[model samples]
Target: MEAKEKVYLAGGMESDWHEKLKQRFHNKFLFYNPKDHQLDASEQYTLWDLHHIKKSDIVFAYLEKDNPSGYGLTLEVGYAKALNKTIILVDEKSDTNNEFKARFAIVKNSASAVFDNLEEGIKFLERFSIYVG
Candidate 1:
């Protein structure tokens, strides 16, 4: 049997987007969800996120205007980049110049590629055989 890729979903859990991604990619990837764990503070969440990122084959990050200023997600992107992990960034927000500038740094330096939507990102991963039958 082929083993599913380990995809670390890095983004804001405050919205339902994380759950949507989980449901969409359930069969193709084994996800390490921070929402599933009990994380109380930055320190705890940081440790948990880093641990999983280290084990993951890819880091799929979703960033939006409403969920902007994601310190944890930013940190995860940097860490994943440093570790040479494949990073697929889904930027669903950034309508203003400031937002675009803020996201530009991470997108340029950390992301392997960027997408306007989650479906596009998923399609990009298909080349790696990450889509389910």
Candidate 2:
């Protein structure tokens, strides 16, 4: 069997939605929630975020209304883009007006068909292997 891709989970740390992805992907994904390290110093938090993004091969972003302006999530998306890593965005509302949508390989509604039709998303990620090489 082929190795599962390394996926970085990016989203509003306070949202319960991220836990769903964590449970679903388990060992195949790395869940990065800065809120978990709220007690950590600012410098430590910054370093941890940078490290996680650097180590990830792909990013799965959850766009929740709780964080309409998710700075950390946006930063991770930009970093992943700079590293030429693949991105899959999950939003409850199917809005494609965002600039990041143009850059992502897949942008689907998280609440509905996105999870049901995950094969297309995974295949979109497979394309990254070519870039990884």
Candidate 3:
């Protein structure tokens, strides 16, 4: 049997998006969830994130105006891009100003695919899993 693709989940910690993503992609992908790891105020958290990003086939990130966006998320996205992993970025940019200037170029261009809605991105990933798996 073919191995399931690994997805490094990176995004806002405030939301339950991780659970939602897992529910949707459970059969098709395996996830490296940061929440399952014990990440305190230490360098080990960053190390773990980088390690998982390196190991993943896809980097799924979610960013919105309501949720707190941080440099850590930007770092993960850029690293995924550098590694040439399939990047699926869900950007809910409702503002006319477009606040996310450099979420590592994710708002405009960095990701392999960008979506306005989370469900849309999930659908794309489902199809992607079918083709790539």
Candidate 4:
């Protein structure tokens, strides 16, 4: 049997969508939630974040505007990109701004990109799996 891929969830920390990703990808991939850990030092935590990104085979990001967590998600996306990790971007209500479009254009061009729904995103990721077991 082929091994399941490990996907890192990069998104708003307090958002409820994390659970949805967990439920949908549970069978095909192992999802890592970086916010679950609490480290004492800021630098140490940053290192941990990078470690998690490095360990992941792919990254699934949820982007939302006016979200305080957007900055962190953006950083994670950039980090994953630098590591050459496969990325999947989900943005349901994206603003029609040039900057937002430009920033995510590369990801949209290369990896699977989904908008407006969780089911579509889940279906998109399913294509990457060669086998369930």
User: CA lDDT, every prediction?
Assistant: 0.79, 0.57, 0.79, 0.73
Which regions of candidate 2 fall more than 4 Å away from where they truly are? 27-39, 92-133
**What ranges in model 1 sit over 4 Å off?**
99-103, 130-133
Score candidate 4 by TM-score against the native.
0.77
Clashes of 3: 0
lDDT of 3 at 121: 83
lDDT of candidate 1 at residue 35, scale 0 to 100? 85
Residue-wise C-alpha lDDT for candidate 3, range 17-129, written one tens digit per residue: 89998987778899999877878965999999999999999988777656555566678888998999999987774342344553335434878898878888888878767
Write one digit per residue (lDDT tens) for candidate 2, span 99-126: 6445332334221223323345444544
Best candidate, TM-score: 3
Residue 119 of candidate 1: its Cα lDDT? 78
Best-to-worst order by lDDT is: 1, 3, 4, 2
Q: Is candidate 2 or candidate 3 better by lDDT?
A: 3
Better of 1 and 3 by TM-score: 3
- Note the residue pairs that clash in candidate 4: none
